[model samples]
Target: MAGPRHVRPGPMVEAWLIEAMERYNEESLERREAYAAQVHLPGAVLQDLVWWALQALPDEILVGLDVDGSQAHQPDVEAAFAGEAHRDGLFAGQGFVISEAAVVNRGDSYSVHHLPEDWTDDLFRSDRGNRGGRFTHWLHTHPNAPAVPSGADADAAQETLGVDMILGLRFSPEGPLPWFDDVDGTRRTLAAPEQPRRFGRRGPPVLGVAPSGHRIHEIQLIAFHRTGLGVNVVLVDDEGWPYGWSQD
Candidate 1:
């Protein structure tokens, strides 16, 4: 019989995974019905945009959108940090871009120019430019799969995406919902207060909820790599994964 080999995971990795798993189980609960709350951002409506964007693009690719507004609104302070981990960067020629949940695009191409000028121009032009995107975050479908990020997802998220990532699960009985920030090496589950399952004319919307049970609507997850200049948005999926013409 061969002796047991030593397999060790770094302390940091172990800690992060523990944290993520704790979050996952803690937030896990019976699917319920709740109200949708809206969040206002500068470039464009991120939350609402994400819902439609995910539906349109069902495959795995980062996204970038041009959100040009006469004015930028005051960012939500608390909400900003909720899933910040999932917001990571990819090391392309340019600097880093935030990678949110996985992005799913059906058959349409969108441009991203609404991000902060410093972020888009400078970072996108940097060595890690491939990481940044004007798009919000990444999103993908599990195909009636689990709501958890897979080993491949975890790897891509850490190396490719460069930040925390969100996973969207497509359950048949329902449509699609999202889970965020398992990149710390741990699996953290995000959710709202448990409510009685309510079937509506439409399916569930991918968004965050407030303490008041209001869904943070019209919000989109954008990723920006840490640059001396500022954060830049990358043109990738909400999950911060790579994207190409041939990719999904």
Candidate 2:
């Protein structure tokens, strides 16, 4: 929706992603090792690019923000790092795109010299349930970087052919591959560093205590979404965390 806001993750969602990140890292390491062994390269020479999608708006059917009818044409990372890979002789490379679109309707059409792969379809054909209606984005891979959106990728976003996109790259197998986005389209890319992890503390449990000769206890869980700022807040006993909520 608007520009990026530094929001902390909620207890539930934070725990989810933290767990997901652990599994993700383990899987990535496994993939790297497998690829290295197959290619007879050092395990350190393969890298995985982690991608995250952003939604412009949160889904609010009750509020009547029915974000329906969207499409994602085929996106290609072929031209993304081809030249770099050829010259660099890197073992493996990765990239991904993030957007608010509902579906990756087709394959990559954005070629260096031709139109993007999925530009021909007119109706995006949303999925049947709420999953299809929620804030959605895409993730894609690339072997290297100029790392800006290509003329084609930029055009796809500017023309509203696609919602929004993020492209990522890893230089070497042993090096870190960062995610980047042209947030304001000012030639500056917003680099989303790895989100820091927080250790968890067991939440307080509900217990009955005498209050004026009556037993009372309450466990409050609150989740709030603010469209104006594209954020979601969760409160537990007055502490707050913000999520990168979207508006598109």
Candidate 3:
């Protein structure tokens, strides 16, 4: 892929992605929850840092998208993987597609989350799937929250090389926490509902109903460089076609 384009996830990967977001809410907000919703992707390594995302039982799952051209884009730009070229010669330049990923990090909500020095020293060592646990860019989920970056999320981005992404999943049966929409920024959703909406916003949000019986109200995905410049993320199929690429 050479020209600017979209990131497409293969069918297998898409099957569980939205569900992964839903799984975030399934965690009990009352305590630290460790649900085994893991994603494992096989990739390469760097001089000391590992590029692969691994499985960990952390409070938050830091999903490192196996971004293309991550190295070149590192000090500044991401590197293009050899087989990532698109059929039409158009490539996903601005952001990443969730074709494959790995998991990282976990902790209680009480204290601040940080990549501990021992974390990098021990986990980053040469291993089977990953070497050092370093990544160019990172993404995480916000259960029952909007996709907008929180103050903590922005603080985490400062440690990243390329960009940081947030996958926000909103659902019903909200429990003690209520849905908050007052915070403002550009919002991107999967598909607007077909029903006529009475909302003040431009469109009603796309509602993905997962088999888990959760009423998924909205799925938000966004990326931004550490500098705070917003990055565009295009959900695409394995064939490099935009997901739901049609006007219905």
Candidate 4:
């Protein structure tokens, strides 16, 4: 692989993705459920997925490869993320970045594949053939839920050659969904989650407001191989390098 150019998003790309993410995220909140979409910043020879991962925050997002599972679309964070392969800290060994997201129309889902009505038949069977052959990776969102996989989600991973990712968002006006903190497993978050205050063992929760005006609680992103191993994710720059590469 060639060395990274270490490019960052230009002004136009920055403004566009930020505005788009805000609109899309707010639209999802208006319906009070899950939303799916992709983000990409065009580099000279490739499309960068980190811009998508960063912009779609306080909401669930999955960053994986393009439809063909192409390496050209991967993010440059791994090298910068791992400390030149010496110490990766908590985030290490991540498999892929997104090629681009597959966005559908505005919608809601308790889990993403309880997907929306707009995710109609054409998503599966294209005019040419099954669209499944075009993708090697997959990702989905878990609104008001943890990034952990459900039994159904595990079954869905059987087809992936790269890895599967889950993006979970927890925010307020929670409606009926309760924050599930009882589960045991490793989790990676974009922002450190604020713990709910308890008056006693069963106290009602107190939440905080996010920049988006939602009472945000947590943002989680996790990736796993089809065989059931964790993959670390690091948000990076356009050239497939982490943002901090030059700081050191």
Best candidate according to lDDT: 4
Compared with the true structure, all predictions reach lDDT values of 0.29, 0.22, 0.42, 0.42
Off by over 4 Å in 3: 1-60, 68-99, 107-113, 116-119, 122-133, 191-206, 244-248
lDDT per residue as tens, model 1, 17-78? 22322233223211101101111222112233333334443433333322223223223321
Q: Which model is ahead, 1 or 3, in terms of TM-score? A: 3
Each model's TM-score? 0.30, 0.24, 0.54, 0.52
Give one digit per residue, the lDDT tens place, for model 3 in 1-248. Answer: 01111233322333334333223222211111121111112111110011111111123345555555441122111222111221221222233333334455444322323554433665354441221336555666655566788777776676665566776556555554456677777665543335766668543444544544455566666666666755544333333333333325
- Measured with C-alpha atoms, the lDDT of residue 164 in candidate 4 is 70
In model 4, the Cα lDDT at residue 219 comes to 56
Model 1 has how many clashing residue pairs?
73
Q: Candidate 2 versus the native: TM-score? A: 0.24
Candidate 1: give its CA RMSD in angstroms.
18.3
| Off by more than 4 A, model 1 | 1-46, 64-147, 158-164, 170-192, 196-248
Ten-residue stretch with the least lDDT total in model 3 = 44-53
